[model samples]
Target: MSAADPTRSHGPGGVHPIARLPEEWEAYFEANGERAFRGAQVFRWIHQRGELDPAKMSDLSKAWRVRLSEEGLAPPFELVEVFRSRDGTRKLLLELVDGGRVECVLIPMSKESDEDDESPATSGSSAEPPTDRRRKMTLCISTQLGCAMGCVFCASGQAGLVRGLGAAEIAAQVLEARRHLDDGEVLSNLVYMGMGEPLHHYDETARSIRLLSHGEGAGFGLRRITVSTVGLVPGIRRLGEDFGGKVGLALSLHAPSDDVRQKIIPMNSRFGVRDLVQSLREYPLPRRRRITIEYTLISGVNDQPAHARALANLLRPLSVKINLIPMNVIDASSLAAPSDEGVERFRDLLVQAGYSCFLRRRRGDDVAAACGQLALAERLVRPSASS
Candidate 1:
């Protein structure tokens, strides 16, 4: 909000076509002396059909199409590379117009059906991706090139924040991901838990959500898109109010006690565990919707019988389900997931305490695409941390 700000997370000219809502696009066209409906047409082409190339928009007059091409309606990024895993997980490496890179992953999964599971989150892991045709693909998208929070165990934040992505760049990842889906796979849900603390750049993240959920554009159910954060309390409250508590909220509460959370999640030093749990009490979670608690079980660090019991006690008040992710191994990181037996014990403690818990299976590790493994800095760049 000041001249001293590093850089605002926004697209060129302050907004990109992919990021503009239908009305915003209509206004842009009206301001340009063109028919207002052209805005909706273009929006549908870009989001509803994943057509970003101006040349591909056949519905427009040839003259207008040429003008749009001249005005630059092409996609904002290029698909640099794709690494496909044996388990039907494809990791997309994208190069932005700024020369910064971000990775988005497509995991074709046999998720718990929407009718069967009432939670807003469509993310749940099975031993393998679906092969029998009853499947939905979850696209994990990034909000920044590198992370600022500097969590010790996460690769994304190991190097300090490089730059936050614009709303167009963030939402476009979903459109681009949809284009890459195989014939049998369908893109269903989205997760904002990719490369950065989404709430850190609140404006851009919120704008992207608005664009994605716009009925004429992507038209996604806000419930199907879960925005995961490391419990920035203010952001959590704003999300509940801004989205009417419809967009799913997942907390990366890796530990129940501040003493342990501080060691792993540096952001926890500012927002404590007790404060986070209390904030959810005010979160306008819809009926039958439960906030998801993501606990990363780092071996010998926070994985213990006592820790699990404390976690159950701490979260007993909130209507929540726990996802126990054995921390994914990353380059040069000595930390790791606990032994299988230890992971099972942690889940057992939560289950016995009458909370739903699931062990998240690691997908696409061979291609470095699992959780906490989306670090893509060719050379480390450390910017001064603000939060």
Candidate 2:
């Protein structure tokens, strides 16, 4: 089956109803004896405005609205539950029509003003503060129900793979996440860093990108989206080719060497660290845009100064920025994150080596919404047992 096939039903020639591009929608309308403009209208309603209810679309004729409603143009999943962190992060648990559940998270960016108190506004004159202090939010979306990557530190991979999500199911995460945004805030960025390794489900991930970046649809620019992978070489190369590297690519390189990497990320045995680095070198990244290197720092494992220096040496030639995530401790593994001092020293080594490295702050930990922490908390099993 073509990757473009929609999740549930297919019309003549296997065209998916909800996953159609504007051109595809145009063809569908043409086949149904309707004018081509209807395609663009429907696309705008769904993508631009986030309106899925046919009756709520005011411009379309009642007959067309009824037909569209009957065709199942609504969201593919129902919101099962939402867990909100004290820090304003919200983790959404959505249940697909087929009963498969996936989780997505809404993360608000830290305010720039909070970093320093030297701002003119802090001088306490009679000037009114800017009303637009609302922080931009980034949505972390999942591409599969459970993951097959089996990263030893991750909760999602503990249960093994259930199934990959469809394009509609993947894209609906953003729509669902948007509903939880606070007033004056906008969904500014998207990261496929939730529950699953995106590259494992390449086709659906690609299609979801198309739907999200379509001008008439979600209208998100390609640059604003980041797809995270656990060093799947073929998928990395394919994504670079398919999108010309316009979409942001983040590699989860937890360990510097193959031995350590394979211990944590099982996929590394097949595609080694050297091969992954070579692939990164060849990725068609646009000028001035750097691929993000996500290195999860585990206690006494990959968080030592020597490991940090090795990682720096490995990525020395690539145009990349490193995000040092002190591993989010999960029930499935005994693996623990490094101490704050250890994490800081690791970052210092990378920075001293002339690499741009930032220690990623742990977000939404109170609600189990941090990285590698999205799976059902109650069902988590030991990594040794799961493997």
Q: What overall lDDT, based on C-alpha atoms, would model 1 receive against the true structure?
A: 0.78
Model 2: weakest 10-residue lDDT segment is 116-125
Against the reference, the lDDT scores of all candidates come to 0.78, 0.78
Q: Which pairs clash in the backbone of model 2?
A: 47-217
Regions of candidate 2 where Cα sits further than 4 Å from its true position: 1-13, 111-133, 371-375, 378-387
The clash numbers for all candidates, in the given order, read: 0, 1
lDDT of 1 by residue, 1-387 (tens): 111111233334435566777887789889889989988988888777778777878988888777766655666678888889988899888777656678889876545323323322221223335544435778888888788898878888776688887787888888888767665455677889898889988898998888787777777789888899998999999999999999888999999799999998989878899899999999999998889899999999899999999999999889888889899866647888789999999999999999988888888877788643644534433335422
Off by over 4 Å in 1: 1-14, 110-133, 372-387
Q: Please write out the lDDT profile of model 2 over residues 287-361, one tens digit for every residue.
A: 988888999989988888889888988998899888888888877799987899998888898899998777778
Model 2 lDDT, full chain set: 0.78
Q: On a 0 to 100 scale, what is the lDDT of residue 66 in model 1?
A: 74
